[model samples]
Target chain A: MNIYEIEHNREIVHPNTRMADVIEADYRILPLLYRIGIELGFGEKSISEVCCESGINPNSFLLICNTYLLTDYSPSSELIGSANPSDLIKYLSSSHSYYLNECIRELEGLIDKVASDLPANQRDLITTFYKVYRKELENHFSYEEDIVFPYVRRVIEHKEENEKFTIGTFEKNHSNVDEKINDLKSIVMKYIHSTGNRFESMQLLSTLYILERDLMKHTFIEDHILIPMINLLEQSHDSQ
Target chain B: MTANNKRVLIITPSRIVAEGLITILTQAGGFTIERVISSISRENENLLHTIPADIIIADPSMFGFNILQTLKNRLSEFTTAPLVSLSTMPMSRTIAANFDEHISMFDTAPEIVKKLRNITIVDTSNSEESQDNNIGELTSREKEILVKVASGHSNKQIADQLNLSVHTVITHRKNITHKTGIKTIAGLTVYALLNNLITTPNENL
Candidate 1:
């Protein structure tokens, strides 16, 4: 489920909305909140209730709620301006772990299964492609986790913005992770012929497609939401 | 050229119409006339497989309903490029709606270019995220089918994946269409991409 539906038809972002209902709506939101150290366990209560119970800063809670609830891609001022940088840093770090450990690992197993039965040459080609794509994705994610997130933390702490390594540089130099994945999808879709194992091929393709979709969403959170918020913080720091 | 530059394919048997479009579309220099397929035939369709275009403008006078419909259906299989049919006379909204958008012979160069620019922006961006995400009443099962459909899965393929009959898949698709009010696969695909139901190349970039 996308944020657009929740924002328009359902009112999931109101301060009074129960945290339980929000979690029920999209279980993924749980991990995001958990990253920010907000755990909703056994207490069927509103966001305010949970925030109060956990003694979490109310501003940070609202910032996160708005990020998950708003349909548009634009990050809110509250999220960019007020929320603690440590909170976002922790959230993004956990997301990186999920990608490297869970998503990529699962896809690797599926690829091994699917490519095992193919001819030697075809299998070699597929394996090589997968390895290259895997490396690129890992590099991209780590670049964010190691370089970008820490920079964001420093900026949040009012450290001088890196004169050489601005956010615009990262934006401009963003890797073509999506393009390589797209090539993989095209290769499987257009070139690879099923060797009578239609089910296996379907499974492989479905996994690739889902991985691509998930990665894009992850990148969206980083590029569209996270980067902009950090930039806002940087601007405010510079002016001060 | 960058990916944003419009790559247009003109399919008109009439040299007059094709040249007119070429002149007008290239006047401002943003559009790259990728190819001018003289007519829609088996051969031109094959050519489309190789040269992926951004916009396709076809004059439907020669083929009428059957051929035009066939071309539209065939093009939908491979590319998300907008298939715009050029109409000489006033066309019905239903027919116009079949294609992404229609233009008339009377439309001046500036007007035609304006429509092309509008479509280019829509095609390139996730601006249509709201329209796509308004799937208010679809069940999770139906939503799954919609994702599969947007991913270019045929009904039979989707049925096999879900272990349901093809008929069941078709019914779900129809229900999805009824609820979402988006009938064409291209439209649905755009909606899907916007709502992150599917993935595309460097969409954020």
Candidate 2:
């Protein structure tokens, strides 16, 4: 089953949930586990045990996993309060590297392989569109890393307040990176005539779809979890 | 030129004009001059078919005042490069209208670059719109159901409100999903808000 279908039927990962069982529920969570510095050799270890061993806050780990895996899972203020901002940031930043270095690079390779079988103009168009999309993804990640994350970190750690720069500014300027992926998918679906390399084309399209869904979940965590936690920090700093 | 630079094909009769434009484009820094040919002739017509270009800058004199027809005859069936007019002298609106963009001789380097960049943006967006069109438009009934569905109404509720059976409502919803390629209710709602089928309270104000 795909992640969405799994999400519909799967239970939320909790402190007692086995690391192996979580992957069995939805293998997509394996990447999330790796990003948060969790490794294999679960050996019947539960989520909390594995998180403690990795030095990751269990609450933060569970929050990220549930928010990612469960469609109905919304991070309440209480839930957000239970998690550590530093842990969340580490996970998110790791996610950025994972997306840029691994996911996007893999996509480029697959697109090249798929495009090799297409006509010259179509090949150029496909590769060109992918290149543009990759650049956009890079810009999005860099903005988060350079501007947003540092500001959030300062607010959480030093209680620093800057009126000119806030999470609100980031929220306003946070362009939807997934929409362009959707556009690329539609373009490929409509234009590409992969008669000989049908399997490769499907592979490329599926990877694009997975990336789009993964990005949506990534943005969800940012908007729902990260932003609220930072907002609370900003508010507390103001009162102090 | 870097691999990501916009590939621009220059087709002007004056060598001096092409060189000047090329220098300005190089300074502009996101454009690669793909080719520079004096004019389109019988011998060089096939070059247009073979050369990969993101944008085309051609003098109207090269096409004998018939830009669209000449380009159609020369370019391959798949070529969709936005034709830009490199105006050396005063040209009539009718002749200028044939080109996607017009660049005058008196234009500064930045102005020329801006026009070229704008062409690329327009070209990309136009292709996106065409791709969107390939999904096909919803029928009037499908649109009606889509608005209601986006408003967070269930199929039974929609059926009751629209004076139709729930089965019919479900069918319409399926058609909407099939046409738009958006499966989830949330995705459809966002699509509706984007397309302005349903407006939020903030937008109502």
Strongest candidate by lDDT: 2
lDDT per residue, candidate 1, A33-63, as tens digits? 7655676574768877777677665555665
Summed over model 1, clashes come to 0
Least accurate 10 contiguous residues by lDDT in model 1 chain B: B126-135
lDDT of each: 0.64, 0.72
Error of 2 at B159 (Å): 32
Kindly report which residue pairs in candidate 1 clash with one another.
none
Chain A TM-score for each of the predictions: 0.76, 0.91
The per-residue C-alpha lDDT of model 2 at residue A108 equals 83
Candidate 1 CAPRI classification by DockQ: incorrect
Native contacts recovered, in order, as a fraction for each? 0.00, 0.00
- Clashes by residue pair, model 2: none
Q: Which residue runs of candidate 1 sit more than 4 Å off their true CA positions?
A: A1-12, A27-40, A51-72, A186-203, B1-205
Q: Give the TM-score of candidate 1.
A: 0.49
